[model samples]
Target: MKKEDLKKLHSSIEANFKLLEPFRKNRLEVIKEYVGSHFSDHGSEKQLPFNMIRLFVDIFTRRLVANNPSSLVTTKPLRLRPSAATLQLGLNHLIEEIDLQRDLETAVKDALFSVGMVKVGLNHSASVEIGGVLHDVGQPFMNAVELDNFVCDMSVSRWEDMTFIGDRYRVDLEFAQTKMFVGSEDAKKLTATGKAVQDNERHSTKELLEKRTGFDAEEYRPKVELWDLWLPLENKVITIAAGQLTDVVLNEIDWDGPELGPYHQLGMAEVPGSVMPLPPIASHRDLHELVNFTARKIQRQIHRQKEILGVASGGEGDIDRIMNSDDGDVIKLDHPDLVKDFKLGGVDSLNLATMVNFMELFKQMSGNLDSIGGLGPQSDTLGQDKMIADSSSVQVADMAARVTKFTARIVRDLAFYLFEDPLINLPLVKRVPGVEGVEIPVTLTAADREGDFLDYNFDIDPVSMSHKTPGGQLNKLMTVIQQVYAPLRPVFQSQGITLDTSQLIRSLAQYADLPELDGLFISDDGEALLDDQPVGSHERTLDPNTTRTNIRINRPGATNSDRANAFVQGLLGQGNDEQRAVAARATG
Candidate 1:
C-alpha cells in the first residue's frame, strides 16, 4: 500500500521463500518474475494499477503452490490488459464519427464475452495443469463492481428491445449476473455469523428449488471434477501416516547421540574416582531405533485388530476385559492364590511388555512430531531403515508373522490349563448370569495341551527354537494349540492356575483320542511323567521307601509324600515302639 510497507512485504515474501527452499528450487525467483512482469509491466508506468493487481494474484498463487505444489501447473507469465468494457468504451469514444450507442453496446457485450471466455479458460487450465483455482477465483472479484453494473444495465426494461447482442454473449452475461446476484446474498448471510441462520439458508434454498421443480436440488447439483493437479485423498492419508510413523520411530530409538540424556545436555560430570568416563551409548542408535519402530508398528496392528473385534462383538471386549481383569486388582502379600495367578514369566511376557512400552513411546514421539509441524527427509530415512529391519515387504507380512507367533505363545501358556480340572472350565464357559439359557462348554484335548506347552516354552526361546526347528514345526504346533485351546484358555487363566502340559493331557483324555503317556515324554528317562513333567506341570510325584508310604498331597510339598505325616497325632509318641521306629526314621 505504501512504499515502506510494500518493501517490508516484499522482504517477508523473500524470507518465506528462503524458508521453503529445501522443498523445491527457485520458487522465490519464479514468484518474483511473475510479480514483476504482471505488476511492474517490464518497467512501464501506464499499467501500474493493473500491475499491482497482478502482483497480488502472483503472491497468492505462489503461497498456494508452496503449501501444495501438485495443485497447480507452472506456466508462462500472463499478459494483463484492460477489461472488455474498458476497451469497448475507449474504441467507441476514439473512432466513432456518428452516434453509435446500439453498435457500441453490442461491441461491449461481445468484448465482455470474449474476456469471460479467456478468464474461464485460463482458470480451468491452471486448475487442471498447475492447480490455480484459488488464484483464478480471486481474479474475477477484482472487476466485480464493473461486471455488476453492466449486468444491471442489460437487465433493465428498455434493454430488452436491444437484440444485437449475440446468444453466446447473452448467455455468458446472464450466468455472470446470476452468480453476482447470489454472491451478494451470500455476503449478507456470511455476516450473520450464526450457525442456525446459515443452516436455515441452506435448507431453504434446497426446499425452494424442490418446490419450483418438483425434484430435489441436490439431484441436479453439479459434480466437482477435480483436476489432476490435486493429490488424491488416499495418497495424502498414506503420506501422512508414513511420516507420522517414521517420526515416532526415530524418537523412540533416540537416534540423536547424547540428545537421549536428560534435558539433552552433554558434558563431563564430577566423580569421586580418579577418572570420569562418559555414559555408555549405543553405537548405532539409528539401527536400534528402526527395530523398535517396526516392533511398535506391529504391536499397534495387533491391538487395533483386538479393538476392532471388541467393537464388532457388541461388548466391551477383550481390551476392556484385560483392563478390568483381576490382574489390575491390588493383592495383599498374604493372598498366595492371587500372587500365584498374576505372576507372568519367560520371554513372552517380557517381549509383550517391551512391545507395549515401545508403542507408548512411539505415540509420544508422534505427538511431538505433530507439534513440530511434521516429518521431513530425516524422518523418512529413519522410516526406510525401520522398513528394512522389519523386512522390505510393504504388505507387512513379516510383522503379521511375528504377531501371530507371539499371540500363539500367549494362548498356549495361558489357555492350556482349562483341560486340568472340570472346575477350570468355569473360565472358558460364557454365560450371562440371569439371561443365559445354556452355558457354552469348552474342552481342551491332549494334543492341544502338548502343542500349547511346547509353543509357550519355545516362544520363550525363539532364537534357539528357530534354530532347532528351522522348518517352522514349533510355530505350527503353537498355532494348532492356539486354535484348539483359544476358546478355553481365557476361562482357565482367569481362574489363576496356568494351563501346563499335564492339564492339557488330562483335558484331552476326557473327550478326544488319547495318545500314549510314554509318547508324551520327549526323553526316555524313568522319571514319572506326572511328577517329573517340569515345574509347569499339573502334578508332581515322590519316591516311596519300605519304612514309609507315599501319600498324594493337595499341593506339591517339598519332598512329596515320602516323609511321615507330622500333622498326624500319636505317630511320634515318646515311648511307643512304632513311634520310636518312626522317630528314628525321621531323625535318619
Candidate 2:
C-alpha cells in the first residue's frame, strides 16, 4: 500500500467515528439508561415482589420454549411424495445432523426478552454452528464481541434489510474503521488492542508484547479482513471459505458472497413496544403499581385501627408519661371514661378484598382470566365444550402460531448457512435399491449450483401433531397408534415399510414424562438400537427384509467423535502452532 493511501485510511476512520457520535449520543445512551433504571436495580431498594409484568413475561416465554410440543424441523423445499424414498431419507439425515431444537429455543427466548437478537456463526471448521449471540439490539452497535466485530449503522430510524445494503452500503462504512481491533485475547498469549500510538492512557501493542515476552515485536496494520485470508483462489476469483458475508463489515471490499446482504438481525414474536421504547411488559406496569400502592395503604390503615390510644390532652410527646401496667403490675385508673380506643369503619374491612379485585382486573386486561370470564357464571358448571368456545384459547393459538413461525425461520436460516459452507464435505454413498452391491456417490449436481446456491432451499415447520398443546398432541399420537396396530401393520409390511414399534414408544414416553421408558425403546427384530448399542461394538444390523441404508461423511474413524474438527484456534496460537499440529497429524 502507498504512504498516501495509508494516511487517507486514517483520516477516513476518524471521520467515520465522528459520524457515529450522534447515534451513540441519542439511541445507545438512552437504551443504557432504560436498562439500568427499569430492568436492573442493584441498589439497596428494589421493586415490589408482585411486578406482574415481569412475572407474566417470564411465564409466557417459558411456556413457549420449555417442553414445547411444537418445535422447529427441516425438510426439502419441494415436498417429496412418500414414494420418493431416496430424497426423503437424505433429508432426514440432514435434519438429524443438526441440533435444531436447542438452537431455536435459545433464539426464541432471546428474541422475546430483548425484542431482537443477532445470530452469527463460525466458519465450517467449528462443529458448533452458532459462534456468538447478542440479545440487546443496542449492544450490536456499541459493544459487540462476536467472531468479527460489526457495528450497526445508526443513520436509519427503522431497521430493515434494505436499509443495510445496495446503494445504502456506504452508510455502514460511514461509521466503520479500517485499522480496528476486531476482538481480544488473554494477556498471556495475545494482549488487548489499545490505541496504535503511545498516548497518556494508551500504550502500543508492540511495547506491551516486548515487555511480556522479553523479545522485540513487530507491528503492522491488517488491511484485508480476517475471512479473506482463508479464501481459496479459483481462476482469479477469490472464493470465500469462511462463514456468510454478514459476519464481516466488508466496508473496503466488494461483497462476493452470492449477494447475501444484510440479514434480519432482530427476530421477534412479542407485540412491539410503545412510549419511550420499552418491552411489551411495559404496558402492564401501571396496573402493577396500582396494586402495590393500594395494598400498602390498606395495611397502614389496618395497623392504625389495631393501636390502643386516646386523643392526647394538648401533649405532643406524652406517651412516656402514660405508662400502662402489665404482668401483674398495675396503674390505678382514675377515670375509665376519659380514655378512648380507636374505632374501625366498615369500608376498612373491605380494603383487602378491594385490592384482590383490582389484581384480578389486571389479569383480565392481559387476557389471563379470559377463559373463566368468557365461559360466563352460569356456564361454569358445564363440560370441556366451553374450552373451545372461549376467546382465550383462540388468543393462545395465535401467539403459538407466531412463535412457531419464528422458530421455523431460525432453522431455515441455519440450514441455508450449512448448505452455503458445508462442514460435511466428504463423499457419501447412496444404495442402489434392487442391486445387491452397487452404490451411487451422493454429491450436489450442476443443477444444484446453477443459481449461485439459491436453489438449495429447504422448508421448515413446527413439530406439532395437528395441535400445539401437549395433551392434544399425545392423544392424537395415541389414536394414530391404535388405528395402525392391527390393521395398518400388515399393509405397511407388504409395502416394504418396516414399522418400528420402538420409535412410537419413545414418542409416547416424552408426553408421559417418563424418561426411564426410553430404555425400553428396543427393536422387536432381536437387535439393539443404535443409541443403546455399546460404543465399541459394530452398529451394522442385518435385517433380510430391510433395504434402508445409512451413510456418514466425515474423517476416518470419526464416528466415535461427536463431529470432526472443533476449531479451537485461540487455544492454538499463531506462530508454529499450525506446523506443529500438521506434524502431529503426520507422525500419529
Candidate 3:
C-alpha cells in the first residue's frame, strides 16, 4: 500500500477509537448480562441479537481459556434472552437491549497498535505493520483484575506477555486471526490479489513471532535452526548488530586515545589514576625522580632550621640582609617564585612553599624586637596619619623601658631553661658578651687630712650605690618581658620545653640594684681638712699637731663634749655651799 493511504487509514482508526472509549463500561455491562442470559432457556425473551451473542461468547471464551482461569468453574452456554420480569421492568432493565454494537476490544487494540506503528515506522519499518497489529492482544488479560495482579507481581509486561498470550490461545485458527484476515479493513485492501492476501497473512504471522519473540528466520538461515530456538529470544540479530556498529564508530572517533608516537605512549602510561599523588611521594614517576625530590625537601628544611636559629640568637641583621637579597625578593610569603627555579611543578606546591616562607618571615620579624612592647622604627608611622595618634615621647620612653625589662626577663628565662640543672634555677647573670662585664674602680677620697683629722670620706655607703644601678629599670622591663614571652609558652609546649619564670625573676632581682639611706652628723671646734689642711687652705699648716681636733659623728643628733664640760664646770661654781651641793647632785 502507498504511504499516504496507510496514513489516512491510521488517522480514521484513531478517531473511531477515541469515540468508542466512552462506551467501554456500558458495552462491558451489556456483554456480561447477555452472556448471563444465555444460561436461561427462552429464545423470544432474548435481550441481545444472535450475532452479538456469538461475538461476545467467542471473545470471552478465548480470553478465559487463554488466561487459564481455574476460578471460572461454570461451562453454561451464554443466554441472549431476558426473563419476563426483566422485560416488564423496562427495556433499560434488559442491559443487553441497548445498541452496544461498538467493538470496544478491537478499538482499544487498534489504538495500542497505532502507537506501536508510529514507534516502529520512525525507527525500524521492516516489521512495522505486523508488530503494530499484535502489540496489545494481551490487553484483554490485563482487563481482568486478577490476571493484572499476577502480571504485576511477576513484573512481566510488553511483548513477553503478548507472546505468552499467543502461545496460550494457539492463535493459528483463533477468532483474532480470523478477524485480522477477514474482518479487518487492511485485509480487504489485499483482496485485489488473492495470492497477495495469503502472502500477507503468512508474512504477518512471521512478523508477529519476530516482534514478540525476537526471532528472524531469514537471518538465521537454516529453517531447522528456527525450531531449535527458545520461545522468547533476548533481542533480534538486526537490532543487536546495529547497536554494536554504532558503539564501534563512536569509540573510533574519540579524541582521548593515544596518538601513534613514542611520546604519546610514555604520556599515556604515566597518567596517574588519582588527581593528587600519595604522601612521601604522590603521582606516577621514576624512583630516581622521587628520591631527588625528597633530597631537595630535606635541604629546604635544614636551611629553614638554620635561619630560625640565627634569628633566635640575635642575628636579626643577617636575616634582614638575606631577606633583601635577590633570591629572597622572589621568595614571597603569599605567592612564591618557585616557577623561576622549578620549570615543572604544580600551583599547589608553590602555595605551600609560600606559606612556609611567610611563617619563617613572621618569626624573623617578631624575633628582631627584644620584647613585644618594642616596636619597629616604622611602627610610629602606623597610626600617625590619624587624628588621635599617640605621639607622647614620655609614653613611648616608658613603653620602651618596659619592653627592655620584659625582654631581659624572657632572655633570662630562656637562658635558665637551656643551662640550669633540674630544668630551671634562680635568675643570674648569664654573662652576655660585650654588655654586662664592664667594671670601673669606685674610690672615696678623705676630705680632712690634718692633725687629729677624721677620715670621714673613707665610709662611702655601698648600699646607696644601688639606686644608680639599672635595677630601677626593672618594673618596666618586667612588663615588656611578660608581654613577649606570653606567646612563647604555646610554642615551647609544642617543642616539649618548659620555662620557669619564678626562677628567672629571682635571678633578675639578684642583678637588680636597690639603694639604702644613711645619715651623718658633725660637731667639732677645729676645722675639718684633708692632707693636713682644710679644704679651703692651699698652704701647709705650721702646727700640724697643735691640738687641731676634728670630730665628725655619723648620727642624727650630737652635742660637742667641750660645751658639755663647760656647762658642768659653771654649775659646780654656783652661789653657796648648799647651792654647790645641789649643783653637784645635778652634775652627777
Candidate 4:
C-alpha cells in the first residue's frame, strides 16, 4: 500500500465517523445517564439519592445473561450428522476454552448501557502449547466495543447489509511490535504513534475512562492506536496506526474468514432506517431522572427539621433554658406558658406516595418485576403473584428471543472458524449413549469438517439458555411433551417413524438438565435392560408370558408416599447392592 492510498483511506474513515457524530453524542449521553450524577463535580451535598438507571441496567443484564446459552448443531444429510456433532462438541469446548460466559455478559451489558452494538470475532494465537509442543490455536471471541471504536455507515439497518466495517482500538507498544505489526517496516513507527496520541483525549475511550475513574489512563500505559478496516466487497482487511503514522500501512491481508467481515453488531432494540440500535438506558432516561428527583426531594424533606418555641411577650431569652435542656434536666422558665411546643410541618404524605409511584412506574416501564429483582412477592395471593410473573415473562421472552438469535449467529460464526481455521483441532469429550456418566475422548480436526460449514444449521436451545432449576426444566419439558410431541406422535407413526422410547428418555434427561438420568436403560438381546443387567435383576425374565416386576417410580413432584414407596422398593432388593446399601443407610 502506498502512503497516498493510506492517507486517502484514513481521511475516508474520519469523514465516515464525522457523519456519525450525532449518534455518538446520543450514546455518550446515555452512558452519562447510566453513570448518573453520583460522580459529578458538585460537592457531596448534591449527591444523587438513587440511581435508577444503574439499577435497571443491572437487572436487564442479570435477566438476559442468567445462563450461558447452549448451541444445537444439526445437518440435513445423514453423512453430515457426525460433522454436526463435531461442530457442536467444538462449540461446547469453546465455551470453556475461553471465558465465553463472561464475554457474553460483558456484551449484554455493553448493549444495554453504552451502545446497542457488540463485536464478535475470532481470536487466535500465533503459537500455543499443545501436547507439550508449540502449535497454533484459534477460537471465537466477543467484545463490548465502544461506539466510537466501531466504525460503519449508520444508513444500513443490519450488519449483513453493510458494505464495510472497521474496528479501532489501542494496543501496547510492545504488543504492537511483537504481535500485530511483526516483521513489518510499519512496526518501527509504533513509538511515534504512541507519543503523538499520549495526550490526545479526543477519543471516547479516553473520555469515558476519565469520566469513570477521574484519571487520564492513557498516560498510564502508552499504546499505539490502530484501525482495522474490512472491505467485504474486496475480501480485504487493512490495518494502520491512526495518529502519527496514519499514512503508513501496518498490515494488509486477504480475509478468508466469515463473509460478513469479523464484526457482528447486536442490539436489544431496532431502529428504522438506521444501523444504530437504541440502548435500553436511552429509552427511560427521563423516567430515571424523575425517580431520582422525587427520591431526592423526599430525602431533603427527611433531613430538614423545623421546630420553634412559641412564647408570649418578653420571652425571647427566657426560652434559652428550654433550648439547652437535656434529658431529665430540670429547666425553669420565667413563665410556665412561655415555652410552648410549636412544631412546623415536616415531610408530606403526598411526596412519599409520589416517590413510591415513581419507583413502581420505573419498574413497570422497564419490565423489572419485583420478583425478577428478588425484591420479594408483589401481590397478596400466590395466584396473583404468578399472574404478574407470567405477564412479565412476555417481555422477558421477547428479549430472550433477541439474545437467542444473537447467540445463534455467534455460534454459526464459530462453526465457520472451526471449519476454516487450521489452528483449531479440539479434543472433546463425548458421552456414550445408554451409559450413565461414561465419556470418551474424540478429536475434531480440519479434515473432519471438509465441506461447506454453512450447510449445517446452528441454533441456540432457548430452554437450555434460560435460568431454571431442574424441577422447572422438568415441568417445561413435560409441557412440551404433552402439547407438542404427544399430538404429533400419531402423525409420526403414520409416516412409519415410530418413537424410540430410549432416545426420548435420553432427550428428556438432557433437556431437564438431569445428567444422572442419562442412559437409564440399556438394551440387550431384544430386551430392555436396567443398569446394564438382565430383567432378572428385578426378579423378572425376558419371557413375555411371565409376570412383570412391580416397580414403583418416583417422578418429579412425586408425593411423599410415592417417594417412600420407591425407597421401600429399593430397600427390598429392587436395585443393585450398592443402591440397596445407600437406601438402607438413608432410611437409618
Residue-wise lDDT of candidate 3 within 13-125, one digit each (tens)? 23433333323323333333334335434221333322222332343222212211011011122331211111112211111221111122222222211110011111121
Candidate 4 local lDDT, 461-550, one digit each (tens) = 877655666666666778776798666865755775554555556556776666676446555554543234421243322344556588
Instruction: Name the top TM-score candidate.
Output: 4
Any runs in candidate 1 off by more than 4 Å, and if so which? 1-220, 224-588
The 10 consecutive residues of candidate 4 with the worst lDDT sum are: 128-137
Give the Cα error of residue 25 in candidate 4, in Å: 3.8
TM-score between model 2 and native:
0.46
- Give the alpha carbon lDDT tens digit for every residue of 1-588 in model 1: 234633443344234323323212222222232233344323221222222223223222221112100111111223211121222222222212112222222222222111110111112112121111232221111111111111111221332232111100111222222332243322221111111222221222222222233322433331111101101211110000110111111101111111111110111121233121121111222222443455555455555542212122333333454445584675333323222122222223334434444333432332221111111211224343344333322222332243234323322222222222222212133344545367754333232232212222212222221212223344455666778655565565677545466545544543344546535644346554444454345432223332656774342122101122221213323245543344244221
Better of 1 and 3 by TM-score: 1
lDDT per model, in order?
0.26, 0.38, 0.25, 0.65
What RMSD, rounded to one decimal, does every model reach? 39.0, 20.4, 53.4, 13.6
What's the ranking of the predictions by TM-score, best on top? 4, 2, 1, 3
lDDT of 2: 0.38
Over 4 Å off, model 2: 1-45, 67-114, 120-161, 165-262, 265-279, 298-305, 309-354, 369-390, 422-457, 463-588
Q: Give the higher-lDDT candidate: 3 or 4.
A: 4
Better by TM-score, candidate 2 or 1: 2
Of candidate 3, the 10-residue stretch with the lowest lDDT total is 260-269
lDDT, candidate 2, 1-588, per-residue tens = 244643443344334334434422333322322233344332113335345544555455554554323322323444432212333334344434443445545444434334333332223221211122222211111111221122332344444322221101011111123112223111112222322322222222223222333221332431111222111122111111111222223323333332323233333333243101233434555676677667667657766665466845644334444564455765445554556777553225345545555566676665553242332321222243355336554655555576666545444444444345433232346788755569877653222322333434444444431225556579778877668644576676577565454555557777777778756544557554435432324323346586668784433221101011211222233325543343234210
